[model samples]
Target chain A: MSQFKYRADTEGMLNTYLDWYKQAEYILSLKPSLPDKFKTSKGAREYHRPQHIIICGLGGSGIAGDLVKDALGNEIKVPIEIVKEYTLPSYAGEETLVIAVSYSGNTEETLSCYVEAVEKNCMIASISSGGYLKKFSEKTGALHIDLMSGYQPRASLPQLLFAILKTLETLKIVSGQPYAEVIQVLRENKTNFSPENEQNKAKELAEKLYRKIPVIYGHSFYKGVAIRLKNEFNENTKIPAKAEVFPELDHNDIVGWEDNELSKNFTAIILRNEEEYMKERIEATIDIMKKYGAEVIELSSRAETVLAKIMDICHLGGLASIYLALLYGRDPALIEPISLLKKRLGEKVGLQKKLLEKLSKTVSQ
Target chain B: MSQFKYRADTEGMLNTYLDWYKQAEYILSLKPSLPDKFKTSKGAREYHRPQHIIICGLGGSGIAGDLVKDALGNEIKVPIEIVKEYTLPSYAGEETLVIAVSYSGNTEETLSCYVEAVEKNCMIASISSGGYLKKFSEKTGALHIDLMSGYQPRASLPQLLFAILKTLETLKIVSGQPYAEVIQVLRENKTNFSPENEQNKAKELAEKLYRKIPVIYGHSFYKGVAIRLKNEFNENTKIPAKAEVFPELDHNDIVGWEDNELSKNFTAIILRNEEEYMKERIEATIDIMKKYGAEVIELSSRAETVLAKIMDICHLGGLASIYLALLYGRDPALIEPISLLKKRLGEKVGLQKKLLEKLSKTVSQ
Candidate 1:
């Protein structure tokens, strides 16, 4: 009977998403981020020796850093900690390396935490552009690598993520060469991954999963993608989703699907990269899931490098979720109620102001 | 105009749940489970040699094996694999040790897999009540440990779980004393954590979260608890909930909280124990969740053994979910669709008849 509040018609909504993609394309156009930007010498010496790496940020920007720690934790000799609070853990000390990330450089939470990291005398690094975070890093002499930010934070995942990984390599936690090559591979293969007909597994998935909740699953190293898919659906399409890993899921969650009634409204998207072949447990798992009414989408990784294959698919999944939102005729940008809730919480607790000196430091056994 | 199909009337439905609990109690009473009911000390002595272990089962039973792997993974020298399907991994060799678990030995998937483990020449052991599983184990000359049944498989979690721990100890992978103490502590502490009123965090959590989705977060060792909580809710109340660990959630999922619409319907419950205090990262991350729209319910472990704490809260959470289902006027006992889905699936894909074989084993470098 009437035009929609956000879009005039179906065609208009599609165009709006196109516009969203165009805005993101400009940011992604920027060159090799992080280590390329920092160009640190191969063996740039010296360190106060950080025992804990505290990452402070939220949403998309924070997740990339969190993922790096998760995948690399078993490999990394030191503990990689992700600090999500405005206040520091009581363990904060001078030995901590606190990396404050904000793609917009204006994210309030990241800025609030940056000040705390400074107060605690922890090593601080900023990943952002033209905001309070950028200004604070410049004024305070903290290591600030300007993030190319024209797109939404969710879209600018690679640039922000690259900085965190490069920082880790700079710190001698792991090598960055393979990870850096991943970014190039991801960019090199975008057009092939588009939602053009049935060729796009990401888009085909979005179509098949039009109305159902997604129960995404992945394995050890690439767990980040599953987390990414769940939130992308939640934030972009306003659809519900959750993810779990294996062979751990086999132990308990398999029994859950038995004698349950939720089979109709859910789908399991198993992220099956080249490495999926490594897990014998997964075949049994996939077989078990097939027994349920659940539809399993076998997702394969692309590109030559693991990093490239991971990012390309994860980002495509992000776009697929946005398209799903368009299909549902919902606004992808507005999150007003959550903002209101945060405002209410802020007044009631004064939580941010109360914990201004927060930093997290790691201790030895 | 008529009435809700399954859930009819709220108060009357609760009577049904109480009746199910009563039935479960009667089942437990009549069975009087013994850990050593079908144990063969000679068989156990013969079955322990191996370079690696694969624990096979589903749901609560599967998770117990996984929990041991997660908690003691670094502490134990050999890697443990958890299998949920009706087959084994391709890497099974003469050195492989397999533990087959099925609370009800009639459980189809485990039986399918148990048969395969036999063909693969895996040193095998069985954990179940009298059923096809025990019969198969006897015929196949495999070691077997019979557990008391009648409580829902989800309810008899401790029996399936702890027996595996004891089995592992008998294999010389661990000291048997810690687990025995854990069981003793659990037996002594079940009084306060049982149903109805006064200091029952699970009951309180359920009442508060009657119409909300529970997002349970846990630490490394206790992530299994969060998994258990989600499964318990599924099998007991037929509700959909999700779980993730701390540092992991901080990465990407925090963005899902940025929803204006979904936030109203979602509630996050965090699972914490001693790890919360030791892992400052978890504490900081939980603080961030508090800032967001998350309704935090911190469940602390009673100062006993890990087994006691897990069993105590899990039983309480199970009761609460069933009660909540009753409060919503839903039938807690009917898992019709899930059962039907399995039947339909068995017929649809020629999966049941497919030759179950071993898949490639992951060689973690």
Candidate 2:
């Protein structure tokens, strides 16, 4: 394996990628303890199984919910909903298990949802580094897991995801932790994706994606992975990207590629699956895209478990995005637009206060 | 209002928009009848209230599930999930209400979902324009609504959406139909969006969006509307368009706009809302985008109810996409890529047969 070098990784995002397995390992090593109220007289956990699960957070922190759902598709008995907004669904009540995740624990939207979940009497567990969420959890007796800080929320996905899975395991909502397998797979694959590896798939994908808008496609199983790749491209590559799922895109988005001029500007990256039917549909879709003058790249993972497969794709996509940013001569860690938005939003105070007031009105009703 | 003209709408899509209210009226005029097995001896419909609802469809038909969920956010008692794939969620069982919708009736994915729903014993209802889905419904005793034929599935959205709403009302899952108010709102606003009206907002939007990638942003309430608009731009305008929900985009997507040269190639269309907090967030987001060199257009609805507001946006977006197609000298109804895909898929004989065989294996397990 040849060692690859990165030019514009000012914040060591590549190094962070190399150490992701350690984050997962650290999170998995910690035992998630159930609250006393959730335990029975025999010192065994006893409670009504939640009818559904709602994971609330935004941006980097919020994505864990989607990854978890994609990793455990149809395996968990209950349906999982990811909330990216400030309000909880009307049906979220006592029977709902609400997991609030925020890397900084200060995201206003997640905080709003945390309040609503509490008001609705939903069973709650929260993961955060340190912020108002941890303070609130301490006062309210909600289950809280402390996260190690200092990393960007987007870079801390492993910690956030493993924490949620561990909590779910402790609650008996999901059986068997796949953390070990996921860590092992990612660790083994890291060398192949490393910057020093001249023939790394991530570098090849980044080269093809240079100066082109990427339209990432994934199936039902890897939908979250596709979205995460799009987000990574947007944030890391500093270019617009699109993500759409298969069968869904076949219904409408396929037509968008008919214009030769417009279609040539996009490169479609398909996250391929092994299922025979899905494979056939993807093959047909690729032929159609190619006929319209669009470039296509197909990526498949060799990871053993579902969680491992998802993480493997994500890991490769993350490295590719950073390389793409370097090719564009940009600092991968820079996100001045978000900082400006935050500054402007901070100038207009009382947004959260108003949100809380509205929540209170709903609660009263 | 000054009269505007369309040059390339060969299929009369504008006329269909003009007659959308009639489609709603027609669907509402028919009283949906519940299956006898779902009724009680008290002469009233009685059955276990579904713990959740799943709508299965693709393309034009599948969009109804999203629009309904958007229109009735937090208003419906049960959570609604839209399935765009060949299989149902493993958790979908007797207590889950499955409404399978396929405008063409023979949509492969919907048919597959229907078969799975049957094997899982989900409460099933279907809507189609006379295809295998209808035949299956009749043979299996599932309720089926027949849609008027001859229009493109995308052009027949109102019929499909209203039929689903009517069926839900008949099942006592949703109360007090908003069909009348929605029709009234669309009719009252139709002239303002017609091509003949020079002051039409849709035409103006199309003019602004010409030759630019459209990045549409909607809040939680209008997320479906944003997606529908993106789909319209894809199928009708034959251009790449993107949609992201607000608050969520503020987290990651906002970072993608930092490159001045790249940001100038796109336009942002924000579907504005009335909520105070959402309004503030949109304003902050707009400022950030403008600072990054992207053009921004903000649209707000004056309709009173949620469903009406949703329809109003859809109507405007539909008209705008058509005008955009005309601007590009292309027919709005032409979707040759999708046709080619379908043809290729058809050539792969026994794809559906293989899907069924796999599904049966899972069932037998």
Candidate 3:
């Protein structure tokens, strides 16, 4: 029953926009309740012997693969490579396991990768709400997990991410239900950041980020979280923000801070969690940011495990982005420009198909 | 005789400031005349077969691995993974080839990766001008390639990229000298963008990007080129520019442009080559950018091969950064902020070492 202040005209335009906050609760509930059907699915068994696993997805759906790559990279027996492009790596073949993830089941890049994997004799699995990917997966007898419909792909991170982890467990590549504890932690920690509480960390962070562009920094361990946060700020807040990994940013971006005019417009957020070797380097980078006149905010992780830390900050980032959108007196769910771009792209595809058909007809005549 | 118009105070401070322009020519001439000793170095012969190649580096040095990963990704038999972290992937082992590249031979991440590789029993090779990496490689009997000293790592793309390719050749992973033709093309095309010529495309482009943040877009084939250009602009021009690959940008960034205030301040440059599948998507994205009131400049590659195209645009981007700096009456070589940051980091490291030594002494007593 709690709502933040916003313009009357903009406030109620998107009725279900606030449901994004429910995703963490939904995901945590699914940890114990994720059907046995999905865990022990035939697709997991079919791809169990793969020498390498290739997860093909794009944008929001694609980022789940990145989270897996960062969180369970060293822990996984086989390499889990995220292919954001249309083509699979050359090493992808009979022994490769390809998971096509498209929340809408219509992402072109994921579809192209799926077709390429099929051509290369790779075992295929799919995760989608319901679209071309699901249809194709079912037709080909590949394992397919249907995500809950009606949510944006970015908002369904928990479901998409769990699907990947559960698949890994089923294949015996990783041991135990690794995400179960993290889910419980998220469920317990959810109420601490409710919008009604002025002490909410996410709202406080969002207040600091208003009217400024964010330059997020993180070490390699949680670089994916930074990336996810950057994406959320861009799509959810409709703000231009960028994320750069540490040590890498030091080599080049430090020079840009010399121009106070540009530096002052940026809010640098440093995300740290159990970073060992690069901890001192990150501290130095923060000192340089502050000295350069840019506002610096450091978010340190207090979670017991790396996965917990990653998920925690990621949850906080999602909340911050949404809160920032509300604070700016803008509707959080209206992505008019993205819809326009996609519509135009669809039209172009339609024209291309028509032209190809006409050319083929002329040839036939 | 070919001097740019700059304020008197900014002029003549660094005589060799424009040597970056001569890099392509230098790189080309070195192709045929490269020392036979370097061509058949002891390191090249020591580890001829690796099940997979892991390139460990950061920033400028790290980007070479990306170039190789993109350029020769499909051609190579084994996977070429770029590690910009302190730890190696779990799959890395005795059969893994770890190429640690630190231009100054002291990049902390590369050194950490080198140490981690040694611990994991992975075959290691070191590339640097000189530092701890060289000394360690020598002591451990690993292959070490001492680079020509006294140049920023960012300006040594030709040498770094070629070293990776030559190593690939030595391992029989790729056939024919792939870089020789690209070098020739670069040398022949260098004069078209001479600083003295007012008709220089680089200078013209730099003028358009003078007061605006550049949002660079490129397909998967040329994403590395876009990244290199972003680095050049950030370091040489001291401007904050962002680079996002096509298909990926279409996913989220299109929404950020809805804010006309922010959109009008950005200049979107699309870097294109022989893109097949995503060409329509990119064109549509450009249309969306234009509709959003942002200036869109399409930079099409004119070179014959992929490598040549990459080098050509990268060359142009470097020139544009320098030209923009000169136009702004600023010194291109003044990296005072980066130097200050490095000094701070060094102090931190020294203090840590002293503390550890003191702690050990106390324990021994």
Best by DockQ: 2
lDDT of 3 at B154: 76
What lDDT does candidate 3 reach at residue A229? Answer: 89
Q: List lDDT for all candidates, in order.
A: 0.58, 0.80, 0.70
lDDT of 2 by residue, A177-268 (tens): 66678888778767887877887898899988877888899987689989989889888888888899988998788888887676676789
True contacts kept of 1: 0.13
Tens-place lDDT digits, model 1, residues A205-295: 6677776778888765567678777877876666557887654454445544542354455678887753322344466567666766557
Report the C-alpha lDDT of model 1 over B53-171, residue by residue, as the tens digit: 77888776787676666556345645466776555655565467788888877655676667666655567777887777777665555567777655456656666766676566666
Worst 10 residues of 1 chain B by lDDT: B356-365
Candidate 1: give its CA RMSD in angstroms: 10.1
- Superposed by TM-score, candidate 2 places the C-alpha of residue B268 at a distance from the truth, in angstroms, of 1.2
Indicate the DockQ of the complex predicted as candidate 1. 0.12
Q: Could you say which candidate leads in TM-score? A: 2
For all candidates, state DockQ relative to the true structure.
0.12, 0.68, 0.57
Q: Backbone collision count in every prediction?
A: 11, 7, 0
Better of 1 and 2 by TM-score: 2
Give the per-residue lDDT digits (tens) of candidate 3, residues A196-307: 5678888888889887788788776688888888888888888888888876888887677776765666788889754444777777777777777778888976677777
